[model samples]
Target: MSQNSGTEILRYTAFSADPAGGNPAGVVLDASGLDAAAMLAVAAELGYSESAFLTGRNEPGHDGPPAVREYTIRYFSPKAEVPFCGHATVAAALALAERDGPGDLVFRTSAGPVPVTVAREGGELRATLTSVAPEVMDIAPDDLAEALAALDWPAGDLDPALPPRIAYAGARHLVVAAATRERLADLDYDFARLEALMHRLDLTTLQLVWRSSSTVFHVRDPFPVGGVVEDPATGAAAAAFGAYARALGLVPDTATLTLHQGEDLGRPGTLTVELRSDDVRVRVSGTGTRIEG
Candidate 1:
């Protein structure tokens, strides 16, 4: 425990070194005393897409920061709790790294245990989080149609290569790709309609993307389920997309994909997704920096 379980929330942006870029995530280093309601209230107060709370170290009787290695982590959106959150995980790990120095740590999330490795590259600290075993499934016809209707995107605008699917890494995301970059850039959507569909589907976000190249993609995330219009940079969605791509054989099993996001929102950030043939889990890496008051 770092603080008195008081209001010591640290803000950080993940996936981008610049505080003004990436997705801003509020991190409560120690929330041993905060209940679910309190954590939700804190997340709502922060008004970020998602926030992370470190409930406690996994090991019992571990005193001080020196003895702690693994942690019990929880994630919450402004509206509700999520099983996992990648950007927030990155932010929380970076916050710990700044104090304890870069190293390996495990976060016990609702989905599964996520192993994170942090290292300093040059002057900045970067972290890579390995997601839980991923699953990809074909989207329901009705659901696919409803999603397209909510976005006001024509069926013809979808890229045939990518197809439509629901992918799960730490959280579930609906993966859809636009045939053209222009189609992806225009993102005004029916929030209520999309929110309803997402709720029914039990999805966290819609992974909207356009393929810039075989290994590079421009992406966006519609997070109406999280009570947010869009996520600036979504590491969770990136991880899910990695699984989707690999499962569909859109990319080689062993490949590194670059995701460029938040550009249209003016909070430009980059995320790297690495896929390995031997492992069903995906690894997402990015830089994070503290947002000082």
Candidate 2:
């Protein structure tokens, strides 16, 4: 138990094998008595992209028995509570795997039920989470213009192959593709303006992507609504991007995509996004490691 909170707050980085190479997240394996305020406080104090809290097990509407590894999970950002967060989910699942052994776990989130599978591969444990059924919608022209303006990116720099869209897999993200890798590398923007636009559009992050190949691409997330300038490796956004790619015919229905992220931030991480022909939900897999303080 932590001295201040009286609960063990584990720190881990998701989507990378190296502790300092991924998006760091705070994980509280057991947070039964904490209220929303306490959870928010914990998240704010950690100052990570997000933090996950396991509320409890054997909820009223879960699928498995009381003894099963099923629990209600909640995610909180530094500034507010979010419906879902991918990196934090991976961090929490890996933390649980360290204690309870890895297999299958279901997290009932505010958005919906998310199932995660953890397996030991060689010396490291990797986890894959199946996102909720994804949906992709077109962004309005005026809204697109506003987003581009806030980003200070010219419309001509937008990729013609991947149209602008608002994608949702648990949380909403605006998908904007850069025509070139150079355009993706330059990330300076009006933080306040973008934050205002994201708030009005109810966007969690802007999934800025650039295609390197059919299966390989680079991604960056501007998470203004979460009170962060950027998210190094975002799981929810990656899941949403998979759906967007499939919906826009950018990739085949059943294909695997490798997403390279956080490189520019000097915290490189890789995320694998798999789309199955039989399932509408996307799967995001990555390696997580403990970040010792």
The candidate that achieves the highest TM-score relative to the unseen native structure: 2
Prediction 1 TM-score vs. true: 0.96
Q: What is candidate 2's CA lDDT for residue 108?
A: 95
lDDT of 1 at 236: 88
Tens digits of per-residue lDDT for model 2 on 183-277? 99999999999999999999999999999999999999999888899999999999999999999888999999999999999999999999999
TM-score of each: 0.96, 0.96
| lDDT value, residue 141 of candidate 1 | 96
- Go through the candidates in order and give the clash count of each: 0, 0
Q: Per-prediction RMSD in angstroms?
A: 2.5, 2.0
lDDT of each: 0.94, 0.94
